[model samples]
Target chain A: AQSVAQPEDQVNVAEGNPLTVKCTYSVSGNPYLFWYVQYPNRGLQFLLKYITGDNLVKGSYGFEAEFNKSQTSFHLKKPSALVSDSALYFCAGGTHTDKLIFGTGTRLQVFP
Target chain B: AAGVIQSPRHLIKEKRETATLKCYPIPRHDTVYWYQQGPGQDPQFLISFYEKMQSDKGSIPDRFSAQQFSDYHSELNMSSLELGDSALYFCASSLVQGANTIYFGEGSWLTVV
Candidate 1:
């Protein structure tokens, strides 16, 4: 079965420091990975996605994710964390234009 | 820059009652999807429609049914609401033929008492 995992329940980082939220996925055929963020009681906002080509994909709000095929990982990263950046992050895998299987989600807290 | 729009941002219903949530996909989008998210839980796909036809289905319960209109908007009709049915129901849309990236709405917050 296709599944996604976020090993860390929470990730803490200081403001202006780099942040990484780990994600790994298991799937068959070509892999399509995506990152989404959600604020308290708010709908999810798209971050980025990886279908093919480059391993590194940049997305909205100064966020980027690295798609490591061999590692079966697509980790979300930000060069400098911000207090406002703190939110719940989810990693998902799916075929293009299909239902996505999501990870358990990781709460990212950036301290000021 | 129009995004998917949902109606009745909040709702409260009694057990066994019914509630309807509506969604208006971004213009030109041909696919609509419904999802349910409990408190602190990830969104789970319920159903999807393409060009007014059912495209895919997921973990949707028997108490819930959805359909897309000729205008491209969709509605999720939930019956026999249970306490566990209280959740945020989200409607998302995508072109499917081109972008393929699904865009979501603000979601309808349903509280069953």
Candidate 2:
């Protein structure tokens, strides 16, 4: 079985400031990690994924995440935030047999 | 690029009524997945199909049944609908069962009164 965890229910940040949304996962075999963002009344949109290779992965909308193997964490980050970035973000990933499991989600509030 | 398409973007049904949601996966994609998302909650995996066959099951209720067609389209049938059945139903598709990216549809909102 595989699972994901996003400890924070909400993360607030001011525009132009750096922000981070943490995520952790547990998988039986190798992991495939992903981050998705959902706007109001919309389905999830793919942002980024980590299959292997580099520890740092960049995604759309100037977003990036680090895959920390030792820590078993994949935290989404942004250098400069924008108010338009406010939305619900989900962390999902797992093994081939287990399919994908989504985290509870974190509501990002970027204030302008 | 062509994306997954879903029908009946919004549906309203009475208690004990049945509802059917349709999904059209991206062209050439062979796998489809269904998920249910309640208000302010995360999306829960329901079921998935590969090559017109059931591949895996999750927390899907016995009242709900889904199948994939020859054209790679799928439908989810929900019976004995209750108020708790109200949620945003999402359909996702990928090239294979464990593809790296699974594109999702806009979702069908079901309101069971």
Candidate 3:
């Protein structure tokens, strides 16, 4: 079975500073990795995905993720943080079984 | 065009009562999925339907059931609700079952007393 792990329960960052949210996965064959952001009382919004192309995949809201096959990691990153970026983030893996396995999720807090 | 839509944004139910949540998928989408989200946790897959047929279910109790109708809509029903069942439920739809992006609705908040 495919699964994902998010080591951090929460991440605190200052506005204008770089931020990173870590994620790792285990899957059979190739893995389709995705990142999503969720605000309070809202459903998840798609951020980015890594299917097979470049190691670094860019996504919405000036966010990007680096897919590292050796580390089994796909860490979401941003050059600078904003107070608006505070939210809960989730990492997921897509398998050939047509199901998505998600990590426990990480909450981000950006302070000005 | 509007994204996936879920009805009855908030619900409060008593134990042993039944609750039903509705969803309207995007036009032409063929697959619908249901997920449960607890406080401070990622959404957990509950069930998936494609072409109006049940496809996959995650680690959930039998009290949780779902159905897809005509590929454009779906419903999640819970019987004999428990306190542990209180959480936000989200409905999502994808163009296909495999290797496709799934879009989600705002979600419905279910509170069991």
Candidate 4:
């Protein structure tokens, strides 16, 4: 079974400050981790993925995530948060069944 | 880069009525996946197809069926709609054996009345 967990239901950060949305996962085989963002009434947009190799992966919108195998975590990070970054974030782990199991989601709010 | 396309951005249906959603995958992509996201909920995988064949399924109701066509387009048919079925249906496509970074469409909003 493959499952993802976003411990925080919501995260608040000041614009220009750093932001981190935590994610952890459990999978039987090699984990294919991914981060997606969804805005109001919009479909999910892919941020980045950690299939293999590098632990630190950079994504669109100046966002990145670090895949920690030992910790079973893939936390999304941004050095300088923007108000436009406010949205719903989801972490997912791809399964052997060729489907992705997603976490509940974390709502990020970048305060100006 | 061409992205996945989904038809009927918004749909409304009554109970027991049937609804059909269509999806067109990106060019050269051989895999298509369907997911349902309820209000205030994470997206749930419903089904997937590879090369016009069913590859995997998850949590899809019996009343709901989907198929991928020869051209790699797909359709999801839902019968006996219920209020609980109201959600956003998303279609994603990816190249088989490639990076496997599934790209999602804008999604179709289904509201069962």
Candidate 5:
């Protein structure tokens, strides 16, 4: 079984300020991690994924995540946050496309 | 690019009633997945199919059943609807479900009352 944990229930960031949502994974072997964003009453939107290769993975809507194996973390980041970027962000884990185990989710609130 | 399509984006059903949700996967995609998202919660995997065959299962309830047609479209039949069944149902697809970027539909909002 694979699972991801979101340490924060909510993160507050002002518009134009940088933001981060923390995530950690528990997997037996090589881990495939993904980040998704969901607006109110909407489906999960793919932001980015880390399968293999570079530790820094870029995603949609100016979002990026750094995979730290030793730390067992994949933290979503943005150099500058926008009000529109506010949403519920999720961190998911899988080995190779198996059913992904998702974290509880972290709500990102960007105030203008 | 054609993405995963789901029918009846919003549905309202009474308790004990039955509802069916449809999903049209992206063209040439061989795998389809169903997920349920509760309010303010993460999406939970229900089931998945590959080449019209059941490939994986998750926390799907016995009252719900799903199948993929020969054309690769899929249907999810949920019976005996309960208040707990009210949630956003998402249908997602990928080429073959392995390390592929799985794309999700806008989602079907099912309201049980």
Candidate 6:
């Protein structure tokens, strides 16, 4: 079975500081990892994905993620956090069966 | 291009009542997916349809059902609503089969009273 785990329930960071939301995965086959963000009362917005490429992947809103196969981790990162960037972050792993298993989610709070 | 669209942005239903949510995928997309999101939790996959056929059913209860119409539209039907069923429902579309990026709709909020 494919599954994702987000270790942190919440991540607090100051605006203009770097932020990291941790994620790890377990899958039987080659893993397809994805990151999504959700604001209050809105649907999830896709951030980025690691299908098979370089270790570091860049995404929207100045966000990026590092895919570490050895650690089974794909942690989302932003060079400089913005207050508006506060939202819920989700990590997901896709299996060969096409099912996407999502982590419990991590709340990102960017304090001004 | 227009992204996925779902109808009835909000719904309120009593216990045992039936609620139906509708979705229209992008013009050329071939896959439609349904997901449920509870407060402070990650979105959970309910079901998915591809090529006008039911492709996958997730951990959702049997009271929840879904159908795809002509590859462009889909519907989610909940036979008997309960308090636990109150959540936000999302519809998404994708072009290919496995592990592809998906476009999402604004989402419908269901409140079972």
Model 1 chain A lDDT-worst window of ten:
A93-102
Give the candidates in order of DockQ, highest first.
4, 1, 5, 2, 3, 6
What clash pairs does model 3 have?
none
What TM-score, over all chains together, does every model reach? 0.98, 0.97, 0.95, 0.98, 0.96, 0.95
Predicted model with the maximum DockQ: 4
Q: Model 5, residue B83: what's the lDDT?
A: 98
Candidate 4: TM-score?
Answer: 0.98
The CA lDDT of each predicted structure is: 0.93, 0.93, 0.89, 0.94, 0.92, 0.90
Candidate 3, residues A18-91: lDDT per residue as tens digits? 99999999988889888999988788898988888899999999999999999999999999999999999999
Q: lDDT tens string, model 2, B52-109?
A: 9999999999999999999999999999999999999999998764554888999999
Regions of candidate 4 where Cα sits further than 4 Å from its true position:
A95-97
Per-residue accuracy of model 1 over B8-86 as CA lDDT, tens digit each: 9999999999999999999999999999999988899899999999999999999999999999999999999999999
True contacts kept of each: 0.59, 0.59, 0.65, 0.86, 0.65, 0.59
**Which of the two, 2 or 4, has more lDDT?**
4
Candidate 1 Cα lDDT to native: 0.93
Q: Which residue pairs clash in candidate 4?
A: none
Model 1 regions more than 4 Å off: none
lDDT of 5 by residue, A47-97 (tens): 999989999999888889999999999999999999999899999887765
> Is model 1 an incorrect, acceptable, medium or high docking prediction?
medium
Which candidate would rank higher by DockQ, 2 or 6? 2
Best-to-worst TM-score order: 4, 1, 2, 5, 6, 3
lDDT of 3 by residue, B32-108 (tens): 88889887668898989888988898866899888887646999989999999999998988877454777788999
lDDT of 5 by residue, B1-113 (tens): 88899998999999999999999999998999999999878889999998999989999999999999999999999999999999999999987545577889999999999
Instruction: Mark the 10 consecutive residues where model 2 chain B has the least summed lDDT.
Output: B94-103
Error of 1 at B11 (Å): 0.4
Say which docking band candidate 3 falls in: medium
lDDT of 1 at B106: 90
